[model samples]
Target: MSIWWSLHLRRDAASVPLARRLLLGTMETAGVDPDVSYDLSVALSEACANAVEHGGDTPDGPSEAYRVTAYLDGEKCRIEVTDSGPGFPATRDRPSIRPARTDAEHGRGLCLIQELADHVHIGNKPGRGGAVVSFDKILKWREDAPLMAV
Candidate 1:
């Protein structure tokens, strides 16, 4: 069975946990292995937090909202977070993705997402204005998972 969900959420700090909780609940319901679920949820949280922080504000003001989407199909799960802020810098001008300075609290979210997910893509939405952070992992199911039996 395949499953998917999406949310259009306001760019607020509170929305971070909301997205993470929902992802956790869904993974639990689907009988995914706890360790796999935890890793994916943590990555989702980082992506959501980034959207809430950097996903808004045009010259006029904050854009007001962002989007999160998750998909579970066969042996894989994918999640994407999108924001309406100034998109990432062009590739030629973009800084390399790396760990933040040890003394820095900020700038670590992207790194965390990269470390958790099997495949990650971060870039601006084509023909529009926003950033998209997407990642996916190979899912592991619980021994008694109904989906596995199906």
Candidate 2:
């Protein structure tokens, strides 16, 4: 069985948890292992939080909203978070995961997401002008758990 979902959310802090909770519920229903689900949830939170923080308008006016998409196919789950902000510096200028400074209280979101997900891809959204953070993990389910009815 395959399951997929997408959310178009405003660039607001509250929207972060909304996305996390929905992803958790979906993973739970699909019988995903708790540890795996937790990892994915944390990664999802980081991605969504980044979108909420950096995926917003320029000085002129508010930009378009952000989007999150999740797809579970066979034993793999993939998630993507795309924002409508100006996007990170040019691809060549950005590092895969920049280490946060010792005294810094922020700038760890991308690094955390990379650590949690089995595979991660980050870049700007094509033509639209924004950033995209995508990740995938091979899922493992509880042995005794049954798949949810579609």
Which candidate leads in TM-score? 1
Question: lDDT tens digits, residues 33-85, model 2?
Answer: 99999999999999999888888885557765789999988888899999888
TM-score of 1: 0.94
Per-model TM-score versus the true fold? 0.94, 0.92
CA RMSD of all predictions: 1.6, 2.4
lDDT of 1 by residue, 36-88 (tens): 99999999989988888888787668889999999998899999999889988
C-alpha positional error of residue 69 in candidate 1 after TM-score superposition, expressed in Å:
0.4
Where in model 2 is the C-alpha error above 4 Å? 58-60, 93-95, 148-150
Query: How does model 2 fare in lDDT?
Result: 0.87
What does the lDDT read for residue 3 in candidate 1?
90
With a 3 Å backbone cut-off (N, CA, C), the pairs that clash in candidate 1 are none
Worst 10 residues of 1 by lDDT: 89-98
Off by over 4 Å in 1: 93-95
